[model samples]
Target: MRSRGTYYLVYPLVIFLLLVLLFPFFVMISTSLKPVKEVYANPPHWIPQTIHLTNFSDIWGKYPLGSYFKNSFIVAVGTTIINMLLCIPAAYAIARLRFVGKNFMMYLFLIVQMFSPLIVVISLFKVISRLGLLDNLLALILTNGVFTLAFAIWLLSGYFRGIPKEIEEAALIDGCSRFQTITRILLPIAMPGVVTTVIYTFISAWNEFMFALTFITSMEKRPLTLGLYNFIGRWAVQWQYLMAAAFLALIPVVILFMLIERELVQGLAGGAVKG
Candidate 1:
């Protein structure tokens, strides 16, 4: 009876919080469908009087949105690939190998996350400039990979540590080398955590605005986040088109979550306990 009463109390609160969180999404959808005149209507409304699907079509015709998406995709994918390549081996070493300063190295990685990119952007810019990588997609890929590496290693190492060492031992007993054991045995079992890390790295690279803005100068190389500026004018903002573009930008991320939500949830739960 007490549990039932608590459930009733909590359910309403949870519903209210969900509604609050989803309200902005509702507004974005409503605004995207509103006509130009309706967008600036005297009193803003939750529903569009007339849905304008052309806003979606118009953005592609008017802006270089396709290029923006391509650039964003390249950078995001590149960042995720490089991050995983570096993190997997580093995480394995930290989790399984006994070495001097192992704990200290793990703590150092944690400390690196404490510093924001803003503090290092100028220094990074100078380094990129020196390497002639400014205004290049490779620059974004490298910088994004570097910034996300610490967290990825830290999270993955903790997840690796949580797995049973006996499983690895059995693989080794079958004449599988250490690298083979990691690839064939551990990676498959730790897939949820790997998926979670990949998703986080992809999203971070996709949504990154600061590094893109600083490193990229070519209009053709702009990412989706930077391309949103095209909607803002000197006098008035294009709300309908902006919302439409914003909505379109969200589709890939939404699809990613939909496909891997189960793994993401499990990874989060596991990380919370193990990490």
Candidate 2:
């Protein structure tokens, strides 16, 4: 009886929380479909009087949306690749090797996450300028990779630790090299964690605004976050167009989450337990 009563109480609270979470998305969709006049109506409304589908089509021509998406994709993919390349090796070492400062190194990575990017942006700006990487997509890729590396290493190492050592030893006894064992054996088992790290790194790189704003100067090189500025005028903001572009920007991330939802959940749960 208590369990039944608890379910009744919990259902409403869960529904309310879900509604709260989805309300912004609902607003974004509603505003995206609204005509300009409807957007500025005296009392804002939940639904549009007339659906304006042109906002979706118009955003393409009005702004360099394609270029922005391309730039974002390049930066995001580059960051994820670099992150994985560096993280996999480091994580393997931390998980498998009995090394000095192993625990300290793990904690250090967590410490790195505690600091905000704002603290280091100025120093990074000087370094980027000195390297002549300013206004370059490579600059964003590198910075994003560096910032996200700590968490990736920490998570991947935890996932690696969770796996049985006997498996790797058996492969080693069978004459498989360390590298081969990592590539052919351990990686497949740890794929959920890898996918989680990839998705996290990709999203971080995609949504990054501060570093992009600080580093990128060329209009053509700007990512989606910066491209959104085109909708903001001196006096008036293009609410409909902005919302449309924002909604479109969300599609890739939403699709990625949908496809990898199972792996991501397992990765997170596994990492938490193992870490």
Clashes of 2: 0
Give the total clashing residue pairs for model 1. 0
Off by over 4 Å in 1: 1-16, 233-235, 255-275
For this target, which candidate reaches the highest lDDT against the unseen true structure? 2
Local accuracy of candidate 1 as per-residue lDDT tens digits, 84-190:
99999999999899999998997799889667899999999999999999999999999999999998887788778889989899889989999999999999999
Go through the candidates in order and give the C-alpha RMSD of each one to the true structure: 3.0, 2.8
**lDDT for every model?**
0.88, 0.90
lDDT minimum window of 10 residues, candidate 1: 266-275
**Which candidate number maximizes TM-score?**
2
